[model samples]
Target: MDFARTATWATAIKNLNPDNDLSVPLSDFLRRGQHFAEFCAFSLRESSLCDFLGEACKCAAAACNAPMAKVLQLGKSANRLTVIAQWGMGHDVVGSDAGLAEEGNPPGQALVEGTPVVVPDLSEWPDARVPELLRRFDVTTSINLPLIGRSGPFGILEVDYPQAYQVGPVEISFLAAVASVAAEGIELMSQREALTVQRDLKEVLLREQQHRIRNNFQSIANLLSINAVKTKDDAARRGFQSVERRVFALASMYDHLLGLHEQRDEVDLSRYLGSLCDDLQQFYALKEQGISLHCNRRLGMTVDLNTCTTVGTVVNELVANAIEHAFPDGVGRIEVALTSNREGSVEICVGDNGRGTRVEQCNGTGLQTARQLVTHVGGTLTLQSDPGKGALWTISLPSKGHSAA
Candidate 1:
């Protein structure tokens, strides 16, 4: 039969036998009902563990026809079981504590034996804890089903009726199946909490690493600056200056990457490239040289750290080349524009209003470095230089170049 027809039959049989008999047909019906209850338990998006447990307690009580039900969670003390959720026994008996494994208590017996503990009549029961607990609440029959979780028995599902009733093995099994679903919920919650803790710890470690690496880069830059000042050879001094500029470029990347530490290795190219241009303008002293550096942001995109770094390095080389050679008279305007082309590729354009070079004349170390860096990011570089008018360098970045190999 279809699920709807089977479900209807199961509900009718469940209503007929509130005590839940052990007959084959009844067992199958109860099993189907337990499966449905379990499906609901896992699907519930309750606000808290207490809310989830409360729903679970209600489902158990309704399925067993019991007047009262309680969900007891293993307490922090390990030896104490505290009532976290309840049904029927109103007025909120939550925080009620009972021994975890006391020989006489029903909950304790279930925990100790790793199975269900059923008491047909608490009045004649030898367990003093169970009798006292039931008498105070005017309860007679009780069943405690252990919630066996990954960390052993972590809780108990208790169902109680006002008068005496017989509980067979089949009935106990049905309750145990429901308890397993609750146990899974608790286990899932624990795992989520652990993952959250691990994620938080990883973020902390990443921030620390970023800070340490920045300090080390600064130390190296300081040492290089000192050596460059002491160098007597003109060529050696210029070499030192070039190395310092490259080091500063790397350091700039580190500073920006540190700002995005929470984002892992991803970078917002718009912000990152804008910051790099600002640093370059300051480093090259373009303003003092009567040069205007304009940064135009036309696209907002994010790429992996490797792509950002390579792109940043290329920009640094090309912009620095323009500052040194494009404006030999120390007077010109350089424009850097970032945008996406018609083909959805990121386009980086750096141009200067000064004398430009031919395509075949791209033999300098800076141009060579820029060309190599652009290729590394799976991009193409085009240099256009005309005498007296200007020089324009365009780097077309690939659409899928954001991912690292």
Candidate 2:
């Protein structure tokens, strides 16, 4: 596996998409690719197949010593080769217009005829549209091999080399192996995308389920609050205040979850956290008289519904706990900041200035539960009281691609 060959192949590919902004030259393409069997193994990984497709194309081109290579997909209308992955052509032209004609399109024909097609000097022929692009890439000869999958003809890998270097039987056999990886990569890419879509759909369904359930529970809580308050006078009603606070907490949590856009597939953590703070301020302003919740900036992170629930629940607990225990005199400020760090982790800090608690004294049941949830997700939660001032609870959580479906 020579790196020079890989570089040539990679150059041919990098030029395909004029919109690609990446500047990593041949750094990622020098692997020389193990055997063709490794292609199957790598393509089977459920991740970014765009990388798989591009890298596999380059690997095949390098292995064959061809000047240019392309992994072309078939269109539905018939006899159409869509250049999904490419490696050899120097020009920006793609698809049938790149040089492969309707008739001399060796790769498309091979994919359709279920056999390999070889043209020693594609540019030498009078009917070849690829000559201009071929000359630009310094390609003299080329071969197209079909990559057949479990279904039918998936796509074809076309390789172009110097004119004197004609493709022999050994090269065809080797390309056949490369095409196998290409086929598997395409299949795996399709499967991965489908699985991702299914997982996202399931999250949406789960969020919808949570919304309905929370709404129903909130309705019940409101009814119970009214009934309990009605069944007693001022002294008994005073006792029911805690119950009402708990009910409001539950109601706020449910309402927030109910009014989200999970169908859009990504959750904005900053907007949600801010809205939660806003809801708490509005809720406690009525309960305790007058207190303001303030935050410096709008913060956000794209996350899953489950992550949203966990983070939102913890935020509610901390902010609400602050409102309840610390600032009972009704005049204070709650400060919050959410940051998505340069290292890809998100940090959320909810602090207040009125009253604070010591670390030992702040270890209540709710705080303990919140800490457990944060730590279980491979993150940390810390609470510090300002000693005659307000308390600050900071939660740092890891936001990966996402959990399972």
Candidate 3:
């Protein structure tokens, strides 16, 4: 593991001279290549920054036949380098700081020059702080390789040899390649950390906005309810109640939207429609009138928020219309069923077992509004009615993005 002897042989092999022996240098070159490959694999497997740096130092030390190696990262001010990772002969120097501007600081000099600084014989150096510092660990030679990033040099890879050693071009080339790979890995890890922070902040802000919107909708509905109770005219009271119900419907949509954290653009159709029906039944006091409202979902499906809202409004209007005019004796059953077909379309059928009316003669504003909404979203509405068998309204919508045709 004598770096100087092996480096001389490696240099001879690089010249491609046929007189010199190449067996030993070629074997050493292959061994160094294998170590470089192992370092790259280790870098990819590690996720934590600290662990990656520590293992990188170990790999560098082993590859260069050096007894010790450490990584020094530049601080925010760009004037100081802090020891972040060490492989061997380290007496707890991980948090130690070295001033970059300090005279004879090898790492600082390497980073400032944007290249490698080789100290062939630290023992013969005169009045230098870095050489004096290395004397404590019995080091006579060292090399500092700058870790260059996108902006510029950001850190240093320092390898310390126990003897006076001259690093040849082949060894320096191998170490420089390792430094490049390590710097790129560090940069990628930093970017991923930043993106994760931004995503978490965005979710917090979105949740706060959802809460405020839900509260505002509830307040509006409550005001409408209070005005309906105070109004003396029967028609005016009914109008207020109808407006209040529509406002509450919008509020319910927001509630569902808030619950869907992962799929914000889509809603659970079965759960949303089922909740809307329950709210309408309670609002109309259907149970006291011997009326039961039932929602039957034949299959689970999800649709975008816009389509779900439109479908909910149409169902609300149709159901309310049945409650008001279908059951004259105040005793009947209403059923809402959701189904999808092989044609990539969804169907909602609202049927009641009360008195029926002719489809051609029906001309209520609610029914008209429902039909218009359905048509606006590239969907269709149909009504089937008889004298005594009850009435059935069917709405068909595209399962995916529905827009005006």
Candidate 4:
């Protein structure tokens, strides 16, 4: 019942050498290796294939009681196998390549035969092409396990010991099991990296598309401005100017969307509403009439992009309407306020200290457009007015459209 005490006994059983082990079940030892490999694979989800291999080699070398461990991956060229990760080697083997046809290479043989190759003694081996290299490193024993995944054999895991030790069936089986898990982990990691690259590329293309759309809108607005200035009739000129303001408003929407940088289905309304008010004040030429626009955003919130655009367009139309009709005497102030209540609903108030107009008499195209936008955003619009006093237009938007960032 006491797992901790049992684990302590397991830890105290220190002679991991299979040749000396006589008490613990061999399955227990192999189970520990399997658990260790699973832990490594599970914890390394975000790491690169090389990092995974490096850590794997370290663990494998310790378990096999080997002095060195190396993992080679198949390169783009079919016959080339490149050393990607290694542990405990006196010299670096990373980036070194081995040809498939190289004679007496156990790794190449394992890859070809789809099985493990064990050399219990390298010094006495007569068929080894690189026995001198092994002798130079003081390596006397080696085991190469083919890392075969669902796609087939993709690489080899080679471990080297300093002494000429007899290779046992238990060690071979354990190493083969490790190689199997390593192959699957490498395959999953590779797929994840590829998907990340694709997602990044998609974001870049979307940003470019937004930039192009904004530029196109700006060009159209410029053309409208040119035509408005050249027109002889006052009515035609005013109409052109109105169209130009709408175009610029649409362009500002794209500007904010692009500024977000990442793919987002929601928009920050406080920043968006403030920017919309600034743009409308300039577009309506209110400063020339000694009129000032003040914006008060008390709460920060985000809504879907569609709702943001609707809210922005409504604000643009309402503010423009006030500058043109409310302040007929040509000198006054417009205050824009955005606030949220305890119920999580937002209220946007646009008020002007100018001659007031009745809500029923507000039959202008801009007011009608604002009403439609408000309805689409699932909000209500209320107008308060007195003949000599200022007028205030309030839009109450529910919190349903908000996105929880």
The model with the greatest TM-score is 4
Ranking by lDDT: 3, 1, 4, 2
Cα deviation of 15 in candidate 2 (Å)? 34
Candidate 3 per-residue lDDT, tens place, 254-275, comes to 6765644425566678877888
Question: What is the lDDT for 246 in model 3?
Answer: 79
Clashing pairs in model 1, backbone N/Cα/C closer than 3 A = none
| Candidate 1: tens digits of C-alpha lDDT, residues 1-405 | 323223222321232234454365776677559755664645467447777777777777777667789888776566778888888877458877655576678878876765566787777777546634567787788888777555556678889888987776555656655666667677777777899899999988978888888888888878888988999988898888888888999989878876454256667787888899898888878789999999897655777778888888888888888887787788999998888866778888989998877777778787787888888878899977788889999989888855222
The TM-score of predicted model 1 comes to: 0.78
| lDDT by residue for model 2 (11-68), tens | 2233233325534225323333454556657665755655577667777777766556
Pairs that collide in candidate 4 are none
Clashes of each: 0, 12, 0, 0
Global lDDT scores for all candidate models: 0.75, 0.63, 0.76, 0.73
lDDT for model 1 comes to 0.75
Task: Report the error of model 1 at residue 182, Å.
Answer: 1.7
Q: Which 10-residue window of candidate 1 scores lowest in summed lDDT? A: 4-13
Give the per-residue Cα lDDT of candidate 3 at 174. Answer: 72
Ranking by TM-score: 4, 1, 3, 2
What candidate 4 gets wrong by more than 4 Å, as runs, is 1-38, 41-45, 90-92, 98-103, 125-128, 131-136, 149-152, 258-262, 281-289, 403-405
- Strongest candidate by lDDT: 3
Question: What is every candidate's alpha-carbon RMSD to the true fold?
Answer: 6.4, 12.8, 6.9, 6.7
Q: Can you give the lDDT of residue 167 in candidate 2? A: 52
